[model samples]
Target chain A: MPLPRRLVLTAALAFPALARARDTIPPEARPVPARLLPVPGTVSPELQRLIAAPYPVGWNVTPTDAAGWRQVQVASSAAIEPHMAALAASLRVRVEPSSIAGVPVFIVTPETLPAANRDRLLLHLHGGGYVLYPGLVGVGEAMLMASHGGFSCVSVDYRMPPDHPFPAALNDAIAVWRALTAERDPRRMAIFGSSAGGGLTLATLLRARQDDLPFPAAIAPGTPWCDLTDAGDSLRANAYVDNVLVAPTGWLGGAARLYAAERDLADPLISPIFGDFTGFPPAILTSGTRDLLLSDTVRAHRKLRRAGVTAALQVFEGQSHAQFISPGVPETAEAFGEIAGFLGRHLA
Target chain B: MPLPRRLVLTAALAFPALARARDTIPPEARPVPARLLPVPGTVSPELQRLIAAPYPVGWNVTPTDAAGWRQVQVASSAAIEPHMAALAASLRVRVEPSSIAGVPVFIVTPETLPAANRDRLLLHLHGGGYVLYPGLVGVGEAMLMASHGGFSCVSVDYRMPPDHPFPAALNDAIAVWRALTAERDPRRMAIFGSSAGGGLTLATLLRARQDDLPFPAAIAPGTPWCDLTDAGDSLRANAYVDNVLVAPTGWLGGAARLYAAERDLADPLISPIFGDFTGFPPAILTSGTRDLLLSDTVRAHRKLRRAGVTAALQVFEGQSHAQFISPGVPETAEAFGEIAGFLGRHLA
Candidate 1:
């Protein structure tokens, strides 16, 4: 008889883990190139630090992190509160938890809001590879949008994998969105996220529309992992070079499997890159050359543009996936500023 | 009988010239990715003016500027004196012509040299795709190094193609290196260049060591065009994305042919990537992500490191080839500052 699916996967992965080098080699530390040097005055030390920052090889290993991610998820939600408090220095925003139609979310609001955007709201989703960021780690991006964007923000602390997987997160997001639309004009709201949250932001929209809810005014899915299937060029081309999402077929892929289980990975609600974006709100996405999902971001932007949706792609230099989280990281600052500016054009 | 070599090359190149779009794309405005959006603080209005600074497309077409490059070369050498005068405002350094052991060179000394590095000198070479940068344009990098690095610089207006090509530029660089080493102890000097100058810097060392001359303390080949043959991945991957050298198969490639002529393309002198870098001095190379020659810089740095040479590769974000010339470009400022710091480590 054919082996069971999980057993087959475990057996296949066991060989690689046993055979592959136990140590990891950072991309920056990876030796050497062709060609002439570039024009002078272009290579800055900041870009150098951003690109050449070294980490242990296999830093993005899925299986290695799978247990940790699940453990964090299983760990008391209160443990992440301090991590959320630490994010205050970078964002300078007020954060407090509240129920959105019974869905728990943190409301993030800047000290002051612009006169034009005083009434507008930003809905944010946090990235954690669909398996991590159990609590306020999920609100890091929301804080950025709230503080940098000068708007009231709501970060969905939606249900997640292991205990709550697949459509649970989607159901929570749609419910919160429905509750949001009940009290506020959808056109005055902008939704955004990065990484897994980025993919969920898009998935939420597909579900929101299916539930007959209206779209938000704009979206900034910063480096969205839109394709759960990992079909983008950078997934392979940038493999080890992008230290964050090291390889397409590794733990991150396995995490997707754990969340997706019986769900078709290609479902428009799962991988939004394959969705029809016609009539969707204008989008502004972000990525970097070293982002393993760079192709996902680029292809999604292209897909949106091809469908006649207004889309803008903002890519940073030398950054890996969700590099925006690094405190005082210049690229992250730029990402937030541009997203806000883009929102200024479309939102209230 | 085979047609005369020149006639055959002309026939082969003419068809593509007559076929291409003929629209030169200013590096920033290339159609591949659009909008005037730049990194927020980094992309100031002035720098924006400098980079997104548009120009006639098809400027890289050889036929369009063949006359211009040659005419500038053929014009009275005195014409460059005025250009040098123009640069004095930017560099605040004295510029004048001098001969060292019968080899002509331009000396660039700063307003004041740092006491720690007062005795040190930087031998410089300018990049012109092995064809252009006929005059003071050759010393732009030298001026930056002088003004920012605080080291007296000697820029080799090395012989280039269409008039002087191949071994001519290499010979000139080597002669200058020898003449300089005779005056300044090689230990207190560093050699540097970008593009063709970058490649020539490497070739100069090869030639100098072959002739038993001592090596400089270190070398900085910024975005050096180390390979004449198009074997690197970036030449194809970044073809149109890098507006400076739009396609390796076009005028840039044609220019290499013009320089190489009958020279074996794979000779270590022509493509230094194939050369043995064992016992080479420590190197610091620069390139940008969008630079078509990025692979070249990465490969060379790796080769040198593998050969036990200390090699540091610095790359910038969003920049095309040679973006350092644009005034007030923050990346340029950082490049010069870091090079000066790198020089301070080894030069004195």
Candidate 2:
């Protein structure tokens, strides 16, 4: 195998020849920048450390501490809130200062107020594999909620894993709910998230039931990681084809492990896939075919239906994971429209 | 377990409310029909008998050949000249006629195309569950191919199944290659199909590899029934979520069995996922998340990528089988555009 110098030369020659034959612009010839600059935001020291840490690989280095994890979690969250705030400002929406059960919160409301507004609320959870939190990701959706569905949105900056593993984020989510229900009408609120946030949204519902809290009117989990066990066929099926995230063993599965370190991967409270969904609020699930978590969404929908809860599942063909976050893409707009319409029908 | 009166009344009230909530405006509310009406075409007596026969609950039966199952071996083919006559009248472009082992072939190029004009051919195979020759469905995709890709296409009215089961469609696809190579080139073709045709698009590539024909530039097997053995998880996963075609033992799986008959379900030729794809072309596969064959598309992409073929799988976020054929939906346009871009990169 090592002695094929002529063959190697032939292969090298073929690369350019093939490119010419295909008439493709070489990567170097493309005009766009090779790197996407990180959005401007204040980086908290804890967040800086978390982001700088090499993502865990294989099944080692399981850090289990709620306090340590919370520092990284909050710092990372604090770093990105300004970008989200900036995006909200660009959308001309005002972010109202608020507190949910003593947890500092921001409510994004549209510039043009609609009178006689029904008390519909969209509680959004940002996704970062349960480790990183990018608050800027949901501006488009939040704006869509305000303008299209006529609902105010409260995005939770929940605690993260490792330091806040297992039930910490779930507890924070519930705390927000406990506080929101004290003032907002329970029948008019909805929970929504993408990726880990999506998982948290489902887990929140399970926790709400266990804690005897008021249930939101509806829930929309977009490409949720409902099963932390990596039991979904897509985990094996879509390992490489999905390009948005790192490989599973290093990224998604790693994050899930850190998030569920002390908890059983199949625990309903941690994963939600194993939860009893009998009395859960109506749900609207969205995912794409190419999404690695497509099976999670599908299985969750099936579980909800089997449990006799009304669930609507909408899949976008040829889409990657969290495609709904791609602001200008038609699928994103269409997905948001569908979510708003669904929330309007159920919560309003 | 006779229902109590109170339970029955409760159920009665719940049923109508559920039905009303589930029911969107009927297809009639829209200008176009929800399902494509079969275009009127001349049918042979044998085909008429087959069409008139009741389809079994779990079987996909079509009026193709009256003869029982038999292996079809292709020895030669006749050329069908590019019919400029039809193109002029229909605002289509007639590609030159060529032959695969002397099988006459023609390509119908679309006019007033959508976006790109280079390096993409929606290599459509007409459906009759591998039994009937391509007809109405061929025309359907042709219209879409022309309007969507803004490129030329060739519809392989491949030979049917049972009388010409496994290899005939494959042979026709090869003939399409022979024809294209004889006239144009192989670097600008993308295979596409629906139902049985979708299965053939997949199966054809498996055959193309065996025959050493140039692989298609790319492939889009829409709602393909790749698991002829009915082994995919979606057979049960999408049983009720899918509305257009019945599931599990319905039209798709039944057609697969009838066409495949006693063939090994894992035979890669019958089910491309089983085939070794060392040299297959890049592909863009599509399916509705709700389609029973959604897993088929997922499995194919996974396998293709595992074998190192570049693949982009697109699942329409929320749709039934072959939703792209519906036309005018933003999803259809998006899917077609992605396929075009993929083809352009690979085929150009």
Best candidate (score: lDDT): 1
Top candidate when judged by TM-score against the true structure: 1
TM-score to true structure, per model: 0.50, 0.47
- Which digits, one per residue and each the tens of the lDDT, describe model 1 over residues A1-348? 221122111000001111112114211111112222221212234433434433322333444344554543443233344455756665688888888978999888887778888889888887866766656656767777777768788988888876677888888888889999999999899888888878998998888888899999999898888888756545644555554555665557877887886899999898988787888999988776557776677667756755767776555544567665554445455568768988988986
Model 1 residue A178 CA deviation (Å) reads: 41
How do the residues B141-228 of candidate 2 rate in per-residue lDDT, one tens digit apiece? 5545565667677676566655566666677777776666656667766777765666778778777777767776777776676667
Listed models, DockQ each: 0.02, 0.02
Clashes of each: 28, 28
Per-residue CA lDDT of model 1 for B1-348, tens digit only, reads 111111111000001111111114211211112212222122234333322322213334443345544643333222333445655676688877887666678899898888988888889888767776555656767877888778889887777767676888888888888877887799999999887778888888788778999999999998778888876556644554454555675556767787887888878887787787888888887776556677677667756755767666555544556655443455566667667777788875
* Model 1 spans with C-alpha error above 4 angstroms: A1-348, B1-45, B55-60, B64-84
TM-score of model number 2: 0.47
**Residue B156, candidate 1: C-alpha displacement in angstroms:** 0.9
Each prediction's RMSD to truth: 22.2, 22.0
